[model samples]
Target: MSARRIDRRGFLKTAATLAAPIIIPASALGLGRKIPSERITIGVIGLGGRGTQVLKDLLKLPDAQVIALCDVHPEHHREFENGKGPRLGSTPARELVDKAEQARSGQPGKPCFVTGDHRELIDRPDLDAVLVATPDHWHAAITLDALRSGKDVYCEKPVTHLFAEGQAVYREVAARKAVFQTGSQQRSDALFQQAAEIVRNGHLGKIRSIEVGLPPGYDKPMGSTEVKTPPAGLDYDRWCGPSPKLPYMNARHHRWWRGQRAYGGGVLMDWIGHHNDIAHWAIGEELGGPTRVESVGWTTPDVDIYDTPVDYEIACEYAGGITSRISTKVTEGTKWIGENGWLWVTRGKIKCSNAALLDKSFDRGEWVAGPTGSHVANFLNCVRSRAACIAPAEQAHRSITPGHLGYVSFSLKRPLRWDAKSESVIDDSDADQLLKKSESRAPWA
Candidate 1:
């Protein structure tokens, strides 16, 4: 509650236990048909590109108020209004605080708490939920911490950087009964929902195969070999969080970290959580995944900047003889082929083998793939109503597993047989070793 910036000293104390009960402070609960004063108080962690975009979307909602923000990069919190810093063509975190103030009917807004440590934000009993748009590696740790601290979470996807961390996140969400919305916003798109309905309604009978396309990797390798002084105001050490504290490079510091194996899984992990999730939804396998995975990929020629695969093909065989082929070769949407017909859907377009399938109407209460509102709006509604979100944490975990398996199989250069229930690989000790959850680096571990 103090106005002082949170000091990072001793912040990496043992992670709060995951077994805590759902401790919703009284103000957040029992407000049936509540008024605007009962608006949801949100805290945002990570204020990079995606974080800023999501924050803007949240700002549009009158019932949600962003009360605090935390980012390791202090430049993000720079006051753009004063025009006093190195200007990047990016939105500063302070804009959200200003907007939050305007939303408060011209009265002075509560001070927007800023911190480099997310733990301080999550531990606040006053905060209702936190939007976690941190890097992929930090996703599991931060989301788990928030849920264990009794806050609902809207975690950006691929919900887990490593495959094994999915189950732990899923388990904690279930145990705490906290609403978690994965930031796979495609689940809320109408075209995607229509395609999922066609598939679910048996309009695409006995799915033969689904082809998923994701964004291609960097034509040139990403990241920098140069080690320089950490930028002023940026706590590069805390930014590295659970991953190896590699030397600071501008390329890997902010947005470009997506192309690195340490912080992300290249384009495959970056886009798979969106497109591959649709593939799983259409195949009626949102809760489980393929039994086997095999992949081959090319690591960039120059390892100085990027080491993640530059190109790859992955094939997964699911139960009931369903097959999914995910690669950089196909188009950006999912194409579901089946005995009766096929439906292909993407952000703004939907095409089907039977033209009528595109116009088919569903009966009331029929199963639909998405929520009726924007992804962020749905998370806020669920935060209030205690309803399950469309992109629940468990489904996001299952949806993203193929991407993880693909990366691991490509790195190991071997096929892997997965036991989805056990969340392990079958009979391959080498691949099995890769399935273990990542141990947080020292002090945080």
Candidate 2:
């Protein structure tokens, strides 16, 4: 299904000709409710929960077509059914795409190719873009592959599994000059953009400090320790990929992998890209790293299946003179305390101590523009225009850097100094080594 490409892709501008709050919603361009002719062919490589959601967004894009699906696990029609959360792998995603195309075009469209190997999909010559919704560990490797293949990428957030991967991703995107959008959806929301603009344009005056709160460990890590045969539909070995091969456990697959460091980086890495990205956006520090970072009051789970901390606080000092504290124990949002007042933003809401700013439009026209419109639409629009996305690779790498550094500092129970320009830890060999993945991560690392 596709629509004739038009000239509507753009941002709402302010009186000064800078992109400002879009007075009209993204729906005017058919964000999700309508469909137009497609222009960009897409291959989707992880048909799990997040994959399905993003696929829904793709289905709505008039300039994009999802033509391929890949996942280690296929649908089993069980408790964790396909098209839903726990297991809706490749085959099911194929079904969904077909239905959407047919419904949008009023005719059965070309069938989507389904496979377990991502390399297979990337080999397709027609694909102009790839969506990577796999586990955090697979992000950099798959993204690197797609970029090398000349495919634009829309990878899910927390773009790198480890610090070195971040560097690799940033470098590759720059070298290729490919359009890459990290699934930092918050960047596309108007309220978040508004909040960041207000702070950025000096509407909040100078900043005092930032407090970012994230949730604790993702889900309960208390399943039975018994290892079992992986479901027949799952290719468990490929699922583990570069991560250490452990006996199959339901808790380690599907949506539960984040609790372990080997497969996922737990809550710290999980939510870091989100709230922290907003923090960086507010301050116009999208490509910068914290000068120093330390973590304290940290504790990990007792179960061997999980090693990520359940309780922790990370304090980071930046070269820009603003300090940020990120912890699961805080209020679960990004709050900027400024000299004049404060501004806070979370999903679906935005508030400020000086309430007038919320309605002020920050239109004093200092050109504090940021990402606007629907996140998914923003990526597709950039794909067609070959323009830089709202959340590009470097910003994604920088957004999650503090969290990765915090994890290392927390694991070592010490403070570490970071040289932002060099993107390395100073005077700490142990800390520096943690920046890269282990030897087992191999060619991908």
Candidate 3:
């Protein structure tokens, strides 16, 4: 298939028109008691650890059912069926099957269909939404396909593998009027929510700079260079999907793929979706992005095995005089610095330079200005209510832009100014070119 190029202006124009109305279908307007048959049916596209957790959680919801599972690795399905494989912490796939079946109250119900091809699962007419737990590179492509198939999406974070893909995915989501929730679970955390509200309401006085820190990249040795035969029951070709098809490298599959730039963008890209997003959210620019990004990185010296940065720092300046200093070296949290005092917030804890800062409180409506409920539950609610998900496509796209720019700047060895309106690097043609999609492997491009 030839590459499908969507003209930005025309696509977005149609999207605006389509998204103007928040239509709640009559069938979904059931308020009181509803039968299990009326529940929202879901299909999962990637059955990795994260996907398994999402499937299990959906099973726990009384009004949601996961009817299909898809992944290139068939072992995932086998393990779920045979009740064997890597432990999925809390939400195991085997439990998902049992819970889904029990939701039907022991009556004859549809089997939990499993397949390697995601298209087969997404194409199901009964599929109301798809939970995308694929790698960063596959996120946008799978989301576009799901939206085109008229299904809502709960896509994992670092929304797009490539910077250029964000706009296309955003356009398609709006055009299809599909409810999308980017899997940035931090948005649902109450401490982060409280932190964002405090910053936005000027509890920190005049905002100066924001410090965002992320975890280090994969420390494991890169896999052997010797090309090995693809493992049995794994479709390496399909596993690579739109990414380049190369001989099997054990380290390049599954989670370790994040260390490779071709498929993932290291720790910078992985954690930026969470920390940088809070940076943007605190400054009230969730739908927009940074204006300039300057980055410096440390890579594996004299080693080709792992290419992702071991340590990195980026200074991203947003449009409204806000500077987000991001680094792997700093403490893992977001700290807002200002004229009066500073507020620092991490998972489960919030600290401030002034004790008085914590005393200020907002009304119930003034609490967090984003979607409520846990992230997964929020998506299911939006699927039924047609209300916008907190981390919508625009926010997801905007949140990851700084990380993408950091990569571009680090590669070019210079700062790059970005046109948030154009969603491209300004002035330099070469840098602008890097902002667009590269050719994918055959049959997927």
Candidate 4:
């Protein structure tokens, strides 16, 4: 073993692979685990909150085997220092994997690998696919690199932090002809599909406005403001990736990073992919998203760490005269108002002016899409089938477009007219530049 030196130009610099624990207890031999060649091999990157959740799901797949895991932080006693959850980071994730394997066979799991660097996992020849559950900023870079390596990918949502990155991702996935699934899991829910069925079936008559209720982003100040030393076993610079080089603080890292503009767009950017994804689906737009975005009622904080809006009330106008309102003021999901009656739906419940809308025997609407089963299972099956998953890169890109639009509009304190046909702002170069800040800094570059 040699001392590892990583410069700005490279990660793990020239290391062949990470120092990993190779563990194979006797119980892992059979149990219920699929035999080699019968299972799809998986390498999971970004062992944070979302990554942990997705990893658990991937491990449960009867046809999938998670062989490798990666994260900047080596391990954590708990996923969040501030909150309670499963232990996180690569080592903790590996421990979870080992236990799961043992539980499967009443013995130790198969040999699993761990890495502090993603490059090691991406370059592994044995991996058939990679699950990218990293931060919003790291999604496109990791996805593009994995796609280039000729591996299928299941990347978490909002897919990319910036609009330009989404375009690059779309092109790379197309060029590789890789099977990719964006982690907007709502599409697989029968309830959400039913909601889509209602709107597309013409049961709503003519839709007038759709109101989407989102959470008010970190209302009180979040994360500690104090500057601190980068903790041992944590590579702060690597965690920042292509984002700006900021001083280290617990508040601006971990779960708290979502509050800052440098990393993510607060709750507005996060939930936009979930509920709005459903919103777009119900309408059945071939090329969906708002044609215009304006927000006069929003609250952007003056704090240095958390710069994104804490709350917003935005209006988005789409083609076919469809209009939408997104705000904390609305109910906590999507509500559609139309000429006949109003229908509202969340993951658990659906409310309508008339109860008959949810009748299974009623017209099921011609608007149909797949992932007939679980979201994760669909991605794995699609990997073998070479078919598109329910939530592809392009659809994920479109779903989050208006959130970006609303973000820019709120920041500029003005309304923006969008050319939906061209996917560009109308005659607004300054605003256009904000949407195009997708460049990765050195090393990541």
Q: How do all the candidates rank in terms of lDDT, highest first?
A: 4, 2, 1, 3
Q: Report the C-alpha displacement of residue 422, candidate 4, in angstroms.
A: 1.9
> Per-residue error at 183 for model 1, in Å?
0.5
lDDT of 2 by residue, 1-445 (tens): 1243221123354211322212233344221312222467889988777888899888876666888889887775333534443447777688888998898899999888988999999988788789999998898789989988878899998998878888888899888777899999988787887888788878778887999999988445644456999878788778888788888776666677888888788888889999999898878788777889999788888777888888878899887589999988789899999899988899998888977787753352344455466687777766654568889999988998888888888878899999988888999988899776454444444
Estimated TM-score for each candidate: 0.86, 0.89, 0.86, 0.88
* Alpha-carbon deviation at 230 in model 4, angstroms: 2.0
Q: Predicted candidate 4: what Cα RMSD to the true structure? A: 12.1
- What is candidate 1's lDDT per residue for 26-74, written digit by digit as tens? 4564423222236788999988768888988988777778888888875
- Angstrom error at residue 187, model 2: 0.2
The residue pairs in collision within model 3 are none
Candidate 2 displacement at residue 58 in angstroms: 0.3
RMSD of each: 10.6, 7.1, 9.0, 12.1
* Ranking 1 against 2 by lDDT, winner: 2
lDDT winner between candidates 1 and 4: 4
lDDT of 3 by residue, 1-27 (tens): 225533434543653443222345566
Which residue pairs come into collision in candidate 1? none
- Candidate 1's C-alpha runs over 4 A off are 1-37, 76-91, 222-225, 297-299, 360-365
Better of 2 and 4 by TM-score: 2
Q: Ten residues in a row with the worst lDDT in model 2?
A: 14-23
Candidate 3: regions farther than 4 A off: 1-24, 27-37, 76-95, 103-108, 219-226, 359-367
lDDT of each: 0.77, 0.79, 0.75, 0.79
